[model samples]
Target: MKLSWSVEKNNQLKAHPDRGICFEDIVAAIDHGGLLDDVAHPNADRYPGQRVLVVFCNGYVYGVPYVQQDDGTLFLKTAFPSRLLKKRYMGGDDNGKKS
Candidate 1:
């Protein structure tokens, strides 16, 4: 899947200096066989064509929220470290075991 984000979005992500997570990291994690799911969100209507996905990278699981453009490009809305999602998807283990 193709992934993309706007310069303004990039700047917004960069604004959070404490986050230490970037678009590049998200892309790389997705490329590394990240798991995709159709989980429901309370604010799902806010983003048209939105998809909720999670990726495990560098021992961390990230929550990636995005919408797909007509050209099949994934326009990333935002990304953040999600320990709750990690535990839910990867099981409640530190070693990433299915359990």
Candidate 2:
């Protein structure tokens, strides 16, 4: 399948080796979320089982989701590294903590 990386994702892949997640790692994580069927269905089964979550390449966990809407178009919702364990906590409830 063809994967699209955002401008920030491209930058992270270039300047900060530790700041960005690999294409392989992204595939692995997505596989765990059961979203791989769409890719592996017609392909050579490259990604078997993947999950769908936001992806953050700012050297953090809690994926910044790249969602494929019902219309079959793709989009990037979050462009920053995860500031908390989960994206839901990004509701500014950190009390000014830079985490």
Candidate 3:
């Protein structure tokens, strides 16, 4: 899938160097068959236009909120690491409970 993000958003993401993740990482993860799943944002009702997806890549999970353009490109609104998502989707025990 094609991916795109605004320059401003990119700048905002870059500001946090500690995150150790970039747009290229996201792309590579997707290219290499990273697991993708659609999820409802906590504020879904407030932002109804975009669909949020979580992806697992390189042992890390990211929350990617995006909109599919008419031309089929995914316009990524933002991306950030999500521990809650990783635990929920990456096949791990929840609070010591077996799956």
Candidate 4:
């Protein structure tokens, strides 16, 4: 998948306080990290015309918000560290969900 970042996403990522994590980090994680799931953004008001791809990377869960164009280009909207842990991406018996 081809990846690109929007101007707003770049600015937001630069302003974020998450130490050692940059736009490159999010891109690398999404490229090599384990994918959790792809779902429509629950808060459509905040993430318009985008979906969220949850990924497990470096023992942390990162939510990558993006949109895929008709030409198969991925336009990354933004990314943030989710409160979930690595275990959430593992396996679950009760919920029967991997993530």
TM-score for each prediction? 0.74, 0.36, 0.77, 0.67
State the lDDT at 92 in candidate 1. 65
Off by over 4 Å in 4: 11-15, 84-87, 90-99
| lDDT tens per residue, model 3, 1-99 | 789988887777778764556676777888788847876666778877688778775567788888889998888888777767778777563333211
- lDDT for model 1 comes to 0.69
TM-score of 2: 0.36
TM-score of 4: 0.67
Query: Candidate 1 regions off by >4 Å?
Result: 36-42, 93-99
- The alpha-carbon lDDT assigned to residue 71 of candidate 3 equals 97
lDDT of 1 by residue, 1-99 (tens): 788887787777778764456788778877777654545553766765677677775577777787778898878877776767778776665443221
Over 4-99, each residue of candidate 2 has an lDDT whose tens digit, in order, gives 546676456446543344444554565555232222122224533333355422234434345464555454323324455334533544333243
Clashes of each: 0, 16, 0, 0
Worst 10-residue lDDT window, candidate 4: 90-99
Q: Give one digit per residue, the lDDT tens place, for model 4 in 1-99.
A: 687887676776777667234567766777774677887887899868888878766556667778888889878776666654334565433222222
Q: lDDT at 40 for candidate 2? A: 19
Instruction: Sort the predicted structures by lDDT, highest score first.
Output: 3, 1, 4, 2
